[model samples]
Target: MKINYLELKRVTAMHAHEIQQAVNHVVNSGWYLQGEAVGTFEAEYAKYCGAQHCVGCANGLDALTLTFRTLITLGRMGEGDEVIVPANTYIASILSVTENRLTPVLVEPRLNTFQIDDRLIEQAITPRTRAILVVNLYGRNALTDTIIRLCTKYNLQLVIDNAQGHGLSLPHGTLHSAALPSPSVVCHSFYPGKNLGALGDGGAITTDDETLATLFRTIANYGSSRKYVFDYCGRNSRLDEIQAAVLSVKLKYLDADNALRRNAAQRLIGEVSNPLITMPSAEYCHDNVFHIFPVLVKSPDTLQRHLQDHGIGTMRHYPIPPHQQACYQAWAALHLPITEQIHREEVSIPCNQTLTTEELTHIIFAMNSYDK
Candidate 1:
């Protein structure tokens, strides 16, 4: 019994008939882009996130880029404005800021929560800091109460990269974090592997501000609110009808599916009590959807190989920190020890919705069996 890291095929198979119907409907509709399907999904997703509006985009990166671009179009942010972001986040989070010509001030994460340390955010802020890009890394909320207050005290816009956290929410509500931010914008990705994944690439931006929402809609559509009337120099990025329709179907089941992932995470946290391995803190369990179950071990490579020997597939969430990447030559000398250690030690095991009880047991046993 081979246990793959994420069985996307099984995920799709879970609702194949429903998804097929939605795809067939979109195919027969003849109105692919900017159609009713996208509009309906946008509205539905906004309601789900407790936001007033949602703008669908082609992919997650563009969703983030357009949010920043919308701020820039409105004269809120501009070239070289510093946006504090997580150093341990996926490269896309950093890319979104740099792609818009905004300076990314990478902040280290709280080793316990795997979230941006709110205590450190104040130190990173300067007069030029226009926004804080808080990422919900590994489906855990980082926009805590302190970070929200910091955003208010410093008058910085709060932008969330919620690409990994589709169905996740604080116990109080989606709006309230344990100490969550009053975010100005939250971006989502429906990439095939995401919690609320579409068949292919998809993304959306949710916001309460009407002006920003309208601007995001315009910017995502090649800077046009109306046909052939360009307002800003924007690129083309749209969530097609099929992906929107598929996402709409999956959105209905997100919470239920997330529950399964959480169960798996809890089991792992409870069962894998090896002293050499460090599982994520269970403190934010209620707030997390467990998009990827990350475990830190002394030798990530050896542990990964050990799991593979047991026929259980695993992957590293990231092998390289963004700052150390070849592209950022100037920041080569900058040392972020915490982020670098996380990059080296983290291993992402199967925590998706499709794992069977037997597979889960096998994985837990394999993890506990690792001697080296």
Candidate 2:
């Protein structure tokens, strides 16, 4: 009855046949990069999100990197450019800003939501402020609407990093925080684990603006619309046809799959009555797609070990915040209380869409068995 912390295959089983067919079609056609599959997937995904356009890239990291790169190409983010980022996000979001030589200002997360503490954002802004990078954390909408308003008021470019929040949305529509920014760049990662995960690494950039979309495509393909021409100093990164096809099949059932994850999360929330463990808050945002079912315990390390001993695996969402990581220790002069607090307490339980009734009960029993 052992359950692993996270299993990627449960949701993917649905699209196995269609993905194989799409791959076979690509192999026979011999046109892999920038072909019909990639184009169709991008178009379909964009339409699904209610956006005007989508540009496919090699990986999710590049999606963010390229988004910033496009901003650099447009003369938006330069050496002195300051980009505000939440301290609780994944490192890729921070890398994109730093790789472009822009200064990244870390902000704390809100107490309950684990989202960027909007109160701190205005204080972090400076004369060099260029943009605000809003991340959709925990597969829930995290202060995106508020961030957009702040960006607008502050005259900053609203960059949307939607790596974990695919298929998530706001009250307005299907787009996951896409409508907020004027020259906004929404980046998604299909890293075989996300709601819209590809077979391997894949990502995309979304924008309603035509010029930015055109620029992103060129930047991702070694700065050339026509091969080997070298329009700008770009690198080679393009989504292959195989992964695109797989993503398309997965995309069709993303919402339904998310609903299943949510159902699983609800089951855990209902049965677990332990006083020491704080259950994950149910989201009000309809766009919420449960990527991780994390609960806060008094001691994360002790609880993780306890679950493992009971044949139920658990993991910490993040052991360290971005600023506290070894590489980013140089920026340790600044302090962020809330982000650091989240790192110490959060633990993701064994949650996957495929867990059967028996497996789920086992998982619950394992967690409930852990003592203070």
Candidate 3:
């Protein structure tokens, strides 16, 4: 009874027939790039997310970079501007800001929720601060009401790094807009392992701002607003027809799959009563799609070895903090205790939609038995 960290094969098997049909349809269409499939998926996804527009891109990182570059093109932001981001987020979130020549102000995340501490946001804002990029880490919603108010008060752009948080919704009041209930620009990933994955790498940006949407679309397509008419010196980042077709089929089932993940996480939280392990609160579970069920333990390496001994696979969402990475040598001396602690102790367990009752119980038992 080997329980893999994520049974991607099983995930594809669940919708094999439909996925194949969609792939076949794209293959037979004779039109690949900038085709109908991509257009259709963009519209459907925008409607699903309650956004006015969606621009599909090559991958999650591209989606993020394009959003910032597009904003720069629109004169909403400029190079060297500061963008506040969580110090605990994946490197991609910080990379996007730096790639656009913007400064990334790393703020600490709250230990309990693994989200940015909104209380610390205003303190970090300087006159050069132009935006805030909140990553909904591990599929949890970081779109807090206080963050919304702060953005409005500061006249800053609100960008969402939603790569791991597909199908994650927030309460109505948490968002400012009644129509969309999301940020001005939200980026998504479909990197074969995400909650809403495609067959290959894929991503999109959702926004209600028409100007930004149009700019992103133009910028993603080699900066061409029309054929051979280059706009703002962009790159080739369009979401190909094949991945778009695959995503369209999978998007329909995202919510249902997320529900299963939530249930599995609840089971782990309820049954695993080990004193050494600290699970995220069930109260905030509903706001998360459980892309990764991370448990904080004193000895992550020892626990990972124990799970492997039991034929139970696991992973670390991130083992190194971004500030400590070799690439960011200048930030090596910066101290972010909470982020460093999370990186040291966090271990991601199997909590996908395909886990069975017996498999979940086996996990709980193994976890409870780990003392070191």
Candidate 4:
């Protein structure tokens, strides 16, 4: 039985009829850009995320860049200010920071959770630090009490890159309360493969601050708050109409789909007992939506080849650490042991709402059967 890593075609087919109808409506309406569809989706998504406002954008990277840029415009942060980010995260996260001329202070993630180590954040904090940008990598909740407390103690802005964590609820009680400040914002990506995906590239920012929300919307729309009125030097990054309508349909099922992903991840965590394979801690399994079911092995390439031989496909969440990339050669001398180790050993298995029971069982069998 051949099982692909993630079959987006199969996933889309689950609601193809509704998606088609939504697209047809847009095509016939003679409106495509900023229209009623985008407005409606922004409202629905804002409610779903429990935020007061949502600003749709062109893509995830734009969502992140716009948020930081808005903060700078508000005089809350500025160029040369530092933003703490996870060292093991995708390059896009760091790029958003550097794009605005803000310095990115890379902190290593804990090997166990594959998230930024909160314990190390405070020590990395210097007087120049103005924000804490926590990435919810692999759909895990990166927000912790320590991280929140540090932000509060130091009066730093809080930014969340929820590109992979669409349906993950903020932890209950204090963790949730502490996670949001007046300047706090959550950035989302509705890429084709995400839990809350659209047919094409899409993204949004959720924030309770009305001022910031309005500013983000303006900056994403060619820096125009009104027609022929240019407030800030912005670029065109609107979400468009068709993608918004499609996202509205998918948004209804996001919670249910996330539950399915969690169920599959739980099965893998409970059943896989290979000594060489290190599964994520079961305690935090439910805390994530399981966008990517990752495991650590000494030889990821060998395991990948073994899985491929068995007609099972796998991928690496990331093969190279951002610090080691050629673009950031200036930081090549920085030694990040844990971040480097995760990049070396991590392999992403096929886990999503599209997997069948039989396919999951086969994946389990293949993983347990690996001896090399």
Candidate 5:
């Protein structure tokens, strides 16, 4: 009755044959970097996201970094300009901002949804604020109508950190107006464990702006637009051919896999009831792809140990708030109670497409039976 938090091996096994074939094709093709495979995945992924362009990079952080860097090069934003971000998200989200010499205005997230509070964003906007980097934390849609309207009214650039939320769609009939920035960008990551994972690290940025896409590709390729001709100071961050080929295969099953994740998550939400455990609000659950099915408890360490004893596994989505991290010591004094609380209490249980029905039942039973 052993249930690991997320067995990537089993997940990979589901498509091993196709993945192997794709990788083999790449190895035999004699061209790895910037080849047909990369081009094909980029176009397919862009179409999947309803964007016109997709620029592949080495990893998720690079995707975020290059997006802002490209925006700066286009004069859409510049150094020291502020980008609003969630205080509770993984450090990579904030790192993307600081790495570009841009300031990150950390806003707390709603405890129920574990998403950046759209209500708090407007108040955080100041003259220096240039963009809103919305992270779809834990595969949930973080974009709200309020945030979109604010972005429109203030003329701020909208950037989406979709590292955890691949295949999530905006609410029907949303984002169709001329007021919003044309070609709004969404960044994606294909780390080995993500919903739309590759065998190795990979990422891409999707946008309708041809200029931004070209610049992103150039920046990721050591700032070279043409052969040996450097445009702007950039670095090597191109998605390799094998990973791109693998991703192209996985992309076809993403929606179906996400639906399976949703089914498992819904069962957990509806069935798990414990005084010591608090589940996320169901309001966003239907829309969420359930990258991580998180729960709050009084003692996450104790719960983790308890689950381990039961041969069940668990992980913390995060245990430290970004603001509290020592790297940003200047902001150490900032008090964000909600964000701190989430970091202290959150634990992610198994909720991937790889879990079996028996395993899922065991998880719910183990959770409900816990007296500690």
Candidate 6:
């Protein structure tokens, strides 16, 4: 009766065969760095996202940082420019804006969806505002259409931080971003446990702009295109051949796996109705892959204790909002009542794609039994 939040999909014998084939091919190919495997993986991933191009990287944080740096390289943004972001997002979201020496303006997210409150974005815009870094928290997509409209109105870039939302869009994000160009970017994290997770950390930036995509590649590879020539000071952040190969195989099943996660989430909502627990409502959003089933509950401490004692594993998406953290305190004075409340009550339940019906029921029963 012990279950961690999620178990990675089994690398069954067949999966292992594919991985072994890839590994053996890589082993003798003598072309590991930026080789055929990397190139093939990039092409396949781009096709998967419906984007014109995809550049793989070492990790999610690097993917986010490269997106920001690429904007600056294209002269779309620069130092002293400001990037608007959600206060309730993962720290990596904020770090990306700051890593590029740009200012980060934190805005409160909707309590229900935990996405940046679209209503408050326009008012936060100033002359220096260059882009909006919107995150699809847990598994939900933000009101990206509304965000696109606002970006158009303000002439700002829309950099999507989809660390927790990989196969999240399936096909929608590419189509949506393709509808508009030069002001939109959708980045994905293939970190382990993600909808498109590799065996290790990885990520990609999807965009229709060939120029921006080109620049992102340069940034991810030490600012050099020809190995010896350096375009600018960039970081070493290339996605490994082994990971890329593994990801190619995983990408094939992402959609079906996401559907499984979604189904489990629906059942959890249907079964859990304690007045103390608040389940996320997707009425306002589009698609979700349930990266985490975060719910609000009274006495988070007692709930965590009770669940843990009963062999049910649970955790907080974030116990503290980013703006309140000490490193970000210089500009953290902004009041975000909704964000604060979310931090206090939010607790993530076990909703991994690999979860079985019996396992899921065990968790639901434990949560419900707490009331009695």
Pairs clashing in candidate 3?
none
Which regions in candidate 3 have their CA more than 4 angstroms from the true location? 173-176, 179-183
Model 4: lowest-lDDT 10 consecutive positions:
173-182
Query: What's the TM-score of each model vs. the native?
Result: 0.97, 0.95, 0.97, 0.98, 0.97, 0.94
User: Candidates ranked by lDDT, best first?
Assistant: 4, 5, 3, 1, 2, 6
**Top lDDT prediction, candidate number:** 4
Better of 2 and 5 by lDDT: 5
For 96-213, candidate 3 gives per-residue lDDT tens digits of: 9989999999999989889999989999999999898999999998878788887888888999999999987778722224633234799998899999998889999988888889
Q: For model 5, how does the per-residue alpha-carbon lDDT over 295-369 read when each residue is reduced to its tens digit?
A: 999899999998898899999989989988999999999999999999999999999999888898999999998
**Which segments of candidate 6 are over 4 A away from where they belong?**
9-14, 170-177, 282-285
Write down the worst ten-residue block by lDDT for model 6.
Answer: 170-179
Q: For each candidate, what is the lDDT?
A: 0.88, 0.81, 0.89, 0.90, 0.90, 0.80
lDDT of 4 by residue, 183-222 (tens): 6899989899889999999999998889999999998988
Model 5 regions more than 4 Å off? 173-180
How many steric overlaps does candidate 2 have? 1
Q: RMSD (Cα, Å) of candidate 6?
A: 2.1
lDDT of 2: 0.81
Better of 3 and 6 by TM-score: 3
- Model 4 regions lying over 4 Å from their true place: 173-179
* Candidate 2 vs candidate 6, lDDT winner: 2
